[model samples]
Target: MNPYSVRTLWISDLHLGNKDCKAGFLLDFLNKHDAETIILVGDIVDFYSMKSSHHWPESHSQVLSLLMQRAHNGTRLIYIPGNHDAVIRQYLKFNFGHVEVRASHIHETLTGKKIIAVHGDEFDSAVCHKRLTAIAGDVGYDLLLFLNRWWSRARQRMGFPYWSLASYIKSKVASANVAIQRFENAAIQYARRKGAHAIVCGHIHHPDMKVLGDELYLNDGDWIENCTALLEQHDGTIQLIRWTERCELLAESYAFASLQPDAVSEKKDEAA
Candidate 1:
């Protein structure tokens, strides 16, 4: 639980203005772990609705304070805005209170591989050009969140741990899976177009790390579902890590296994 043991951390989809942000769990994760750099992938705040109703809670403030402390202590912080907070796009190239915000960025890993870091909303057909579709998706998403919240509450009362109903359905529903697959393909293709060897994104709320052809695709699942993050080790070895239920490092596809060992070794060397 020592915060000082980690190197780099990337997380997304906190939805701070939403009541379902899970700030407590996030605070626990932040307090328990330390990283040299922290990447806030996007949608850290639910800006879409913040204009209509102000809903920043105490826990939300606490999380912000935690990040501020880390940044003050020299942790490099990078933020890429998501669709929900698209307003930040205007200030993407600026710094906000110790956190650097960007629309998207290409990050070079320690192993010299280039990775495209973005929120992935641009790839979703329903999200990109159509406001109506986006609103519909939001409506559906809100219903799911409502169900998930009470469902988890009931589960807890029954001695079961919290679980994401939306995520469970996302993994099983054919249409949802297909959409996610398409999004993944688009992201990977975009990475290729951008001359990147890997792509790390959020906004779909699904946590996954997969390899397709010569590229790697990673999604830092949202707190609403997988409660996960994608981490880039010092040597450029990427990992999909979860934060709930004791914190787990999930298995990731080794599409480019040849590139991994060297990265891990380099990380060790850097640490040493």
Candidate 2:
């Protein structure tokens, strides 16, 4: 990637097989922005459940083509498989157009900032600990996606913006919060130990950018909730962006490898 004119974008948890994947919005975004590099942090596909019985959608295929087009047009793309699509990691050496697959990687920004990028499933003890909970979660998430799709579509007819009902409910569940917190803590600690200034990941479906001591932690969030992403610019600046009724900026801060709280503040005050 060209450091002088290129920007690096990271996104994850797209869950392509789910009806609520929001491929239209994502495709629109890609068509509008010409990034120099794009990183799919993880779970770009919900293969775990997708392989069972659900049929694929045309919108999903369009989104994939859009991405491939960008790669063909000189935009560098990298994909890291998440828990939902962990099997893809087996083909780490493969490349599709300009897109490459990697189990995990270290990204060094133009400004000399170093960060590790991963899908974040390894940090989730429940996902790694047991087979049953993981299966249950996948099934539940799929059902929620089904309802979210039809419900949000109906909402659109009623003049409402798209939103994930499943995500909203998950936020209110205490068990989910506990699980998220545990995962976040693990990622932060791992970054600090690896001597990285920050760690970037996707999973947990929450968008956040935090500075913890000398290390930083960033979760791109997911299409299911915030529909957000993280961008690293050549000037060493890092930004967290959210896509809603349209594209929006959520937060921006310096590129520090350590997870530092308060390093980046949500610019909700600037929302129009």
Candidate 3:
């Protein structure tokens, strides 16, 4: 399959430096797509995990290298650091390599619609105000990811395709679903306040595209779990693309060899 050329691409929750990061899948996605603008929505690096134990693998390095290469090749790179990598917030509005680092950005689409791009953590009640609760939630999420890794590994051994155990569990949990809804509503409100036609953000790791009345709310999802991204087409339409599913399709067609390894073993040691 030919690489998809898009107007803009937004991805986040990479959690690089964390063991659970799906760097290989991200690299594969980057290789298969070219965009005029690429937005690193948030949590590009898991500095929280790195502070305790550094787990920067070769794949993570490759992901960074590929992103820099894309910027050098003239793609506009915008990074909005999230809670996990909040240290970068100190250098807001600065340029690292060819990428622009900002707390938030306003993107004007091809259709002349203004969309606010942010990490969205600022709108999350637990993340913004309840520090203790946020920490506890983080711990719980890490445990979920650990179990998800083991489950996915077992599925692979049984010749089953990749599945997101964490994502499925999140859907089943009432509280988690409510949190997602609140987050989306908060994003929509923020967009309205900003006078934007829509908002694109990542932090909750839930990939969704929805129309709330006359406004739109878009979440790029996360690389660590769902392996999804939000892409803006040339005509300004936005859609979520699941990288794992795309890789699986490519593997089935025997079109790309790079995604083959990931399609078989996407699980990583828990430390997310």
Candidate 4:
């Protein structure tokens, strides 16, 4: 297949310095796709996990290198720091080579639709007000991801196609679904207040696209559980892409609302 050329590409929650990051799959995606503007919607690196144990592999380094290459190649690069990499927030309004750092950005799509692009953590009430509750949730989520990793490997060995055990289980979780709904509503409300037609974010690691009246809510998903990204076609039509294997691409335009949420915390919302 020919390379994927898009108007905008948004991906997030890579958790690069953590073991659960699927750097290999992302590497392939990066190699295959190129956009006029590449938006790193946040949590591109897992600073919180690295604080306790750093796990930077070569593939992770390559991913960063490739991004820099894109920047130097004249692609508009924007980085919005999520809670995991919130320290980078101090550098907002600063430029790192060809990339610009911002807390949130007002973006106009090819079709002239205004969008409030942010990391979406600020709108999550649980992450902001309940510190202990957030941490406990993280612990539970970590255990789930651990089991998911092994389950995926076993499936791979048995010649089954790639499936997200974590995402599947999260679909059955009521509390997680509630949290996700709250975040989505809050984000949509904020966008409406800002007079934007849509909101794009990636803190919950849930890949989604929902049309509410005249507004839209989009999440690019994450590299870990879903291995998905938000892709804007040349005509400005947006879609969620599932990048499982290197050459396989699954475009689920709207059937992903069920696979919602990963983890959220005051400081440690890894995509895993």
Which candidate leads in lDDT? 4
lDDT of 2: 0.73
Q: Candidate 1, after superposition: displacement of residue 255 in Å? A: 9.7
- TM-score winner: 4
Candidate 2 global Cα RMSD: 4.1
Clashing pairs in 3: none
Q: Give one digit per residue, the lDDT tens place, for model 3 in 1-272.
A: 56678889899999999888888778878888889999999999989889899788899989999999999999999999999999999999899889999989998887677889999878767334343233224777888889888998899899887788988877777666667777777888889988988898888888887677567778888877889887776766565667763442111111111212222233321211
Off by over 4 Å in 1: 126-136, 253-272
lDDT of 2 at 117: 88
| Residue 20 accuracy (lDDT) in model 1 | 79
TM-score, predicted candidate 2 vs. hidden true structure = 0.83
TM-score of 3: 0.86
How far out, in Å, is residue 256 in model 1? Answer: 6.8
Off by over 4 Å in 3: 126-137, 245-272
Report the candidate with higher TM-score, 1 versus 2.
Answer: 1
lDDT comparison, 1 vs 2, better candidate: 1
TM-score for each candidate, following the candidate numbering? 0.87, 0.83, 0.86, 0.87
Model 4: per-residue Cα lDDT over 63-147, one tens digit each: 9999999999989999999988999999999999999999998877776777778997888674343432332238777887898
lDDT of 4: 0.78
State the lDDT of candidate 2 residue by residue for 25-77, as single tens digits: 77655655567888899989888658775957898898888889878988888
**Residue-wise C-alpha lDDT for candidate 1, range 1-272, written one tens digit per residue:** 34535656889988888777888778877887678888888898888768878889899999888888888888989989998888888896898778889888777666677778898887866334343233224676678777888988898799886677867755666666667777788898899989998888888887888778888888888876667777666555677766654556665423233544222211111211
